[model samples]
Target: MHSASIVEAYTVTIWEMLAVFVAGISAGTINTIVGSGTLITFPVLLATGLPPVTATVSNALGLVSGSISGAIGYRAELAGQRRRVLRLSLIAAVGGITGAVLLLTLPPTAFETIVPVLVALALVLVVLQPRIARAVQRRRERTGSPAHPDGGPLLLVGLLLASVYGGYFTAAQGIVYIALMGMLINDTLQRLNAVKNVLAAVVNSIAALFFVFVAELDWTAVVLIAVGSAIGGQIGATYGRRLSPSVLRILIVVVGTFAIAQLLFRRFG
Candidate 1:
């Protein structure tokens, strides 16, 4: 009886690990393409029975590899942007540290109450991204003046706030980054996207490092997601652009809705 129980436990653990790995792949792919990959992985982590805070921390850490991969893939677009990247990265790092501190300092109950609301907000952002992009484009075309290459103070402030949010929850941050940079700076969407990836890497890496010392972790889950996301990052850079945006958005919404339902049930059921 003891032996059978041990075998069953190991089998279940393996299955759970596999699920996390697959979720990591999906998250990494989409994160590279457009961001918000946390929507895929965080919910899966919760389903695997991790607490909200732990899942968020682990997700941030795991996706670091993916963010780096995505940035590397966009190296061509990143050329001549070294000074810009460095400047923005400093602000992002500060914001990331602040957000990580907030996450750790807040009570677990507070995080629990806040996360569902955050997820809901992220879903709304995801849904409206297209319209937002169109508006940004229109504004860009109307402006006859040259855009500030540095994006000025307004962009610095915006990026700082966004990085704080990314450090805390990490969903849809890329959309926010792109929107801010698009309006503030004169650059093609592709180049802005490359910068977004780099900023994400900075924020996530800082937050992950903080979590390494302060947060409780599921190492197995973290490792699984890290490896899977790394692979998915390359795939996303190479082929994710070819994938339909509508399909990806739909998938994110579906999974996010399901996750919300599960969370509400868990909290109130």
Candidate 2:
């Protein structure tokens, strides 16, 4: 009987390890390409029978690790964006801290209701990405200008708001961030994506630190996910520039829609 129990335990552990590996790879790809990787990992964690809050906090921890890896993979692209990054990092940090605190203090019922709304908003933004990008491109072309004053202020505001969202739930956060970046920064798409990874990492890392001390976390799951996601991030960053923006944007829309639908079903059904 003792031997059988031990064998079962090992088998379950191996299954979970495989699940986390798959989640990490999916997350890394989504984070790099479209930004809804949390949707994949978070649900998997929940399905594993962890409490909702525990799953969320653990997911955040795992994602932070992945984001850090992704940021490092894009280090070269981060060079010129230093000033912009510095300007926004503090705001994102603060927002993240606030969001983490909210999660710790708020009731699960409230969070459940709000999540769907947030998902809906993220979907809208994802759908509008290409249109917004084209408008920004056109404006830049019309003026024969490389920079615009409106862009920076808008970006700061968007970053602060998005950081709050990301720090809290963070499903589809990348699409929103990428859309905002496309509108604000005149840099190459690859460089903008690098910025996105750094900002996301900053937000999630700050929140994860808080959760580490205040909330219950599944450390084993975090380790597996982090390792897998880090590998995925490197692969995505390497080939991200080769992808077509239009196709990527459409993919974001499709995923965002599915996320929103899932939320709605969970809420109403």
Candidate 3:
């Protein structure tokens, strides 16, 4: 009987580890390619029977590892965006910290209700991003402006808001960030995507650290996810550049739509 119990415990541990690894891999691929990995991992955590707040915190922590790996893989594209990144990073950091504090203070019922609404809004942004970018590009071409589309002020404001969302429960945070950057910068989609990864990593890392000390984290899941996501992130970032922007945009729309549908079904259906 004692041996049987020990074997069962080992089997459960292995299963949980595998689940985390799968979540990490999915997160890495989605984040690097289209940016909605949280939709996968967060639900998995919730399904594991964790409380909503704990799941969100653990998901955020695990995702940071993938984001950092993704960012580094896109370092070449990020080289020229240093100034914009620096100017915006602080705002994102502040927003993330503020969001984390708010999450800790908010009641569980409130957060449960608010998250699906936020997910739906994020889906709308993802759907509209490509068209908005085309419009911005057309305007830049019409005027023959030597200066890049300097949407810095607008970007700072958007990043602050997006970071707050990221810190709280980032399902489609990357789509929102990429959309804002596409509107504001004249850079190629690849480069803007690189910036998005780094900025997101910074915001998530900060929030994850806060939760590490203050919140009850699922360490087993965190470890497996962090390792798998890091590997998957590297793969996704490297291959993502070869993909056409239109294809990626379509993928984002599909993923965002699925996420919204799932959230709505869970909440109302």
Name the top lDDT candidate: 1
Model 3 bad stretches (over 4 Å)? 1-5, 109-150
Error of 1 at 160 (Å): 0.4
Poorest lDDT segment (10 consecutive residues) of candidate 3: 1-10
- Which residue pairs collide, candidate 1? none
User: Model 3, 1-269: lDDT tens per residue?
Assistant: 01247778678667766787898898987898778798788777776667888888888898888999999999998887787777777888998887787789877554456656665665565566667767866876898865444465777888898898778777777887877777667677788888888878888898998999899898777877788889889988989877777777677678777877776676678
Candidate 3, overall lDDT?
Answer: 0.78
| Cα-based TM-score, every candidate | 0.79, 0.85, 0.88
Backbone collisions counted per model: 0, 0, 0
Residue pairs with clashing backbones, model 3: none
Local accuracy by lDDT, each model = 0.80, 0.77, 0.78
Q: State the displacement of the C-alpha of residue 165, model 1, in Å, after optimal TM-score superposition.
A: 0.7
lDDT score for candidate 1 against the true structure: 0.80
TM-score of 1: 0.79
The candidate, 1 or 2, that scores higher on TM-score is 2
Model 1 Cα lDDT, one tens digit per residue, 1-269: 01247779788778888899999998888888777788789878988788888898999999999999988987888999999999999999999988888888866454446556756765676677677656755776798554568798988998898888788878767766766776676666677778988999999999999999999888878998899999888888787445455665565566566656755665678
* Poorest 10 consecutive residues by lDDT, candidate 1: 107-116
Clash count (model 1, backbone only): 0
Q: Which candidate is the best by TM-score?
A: 3
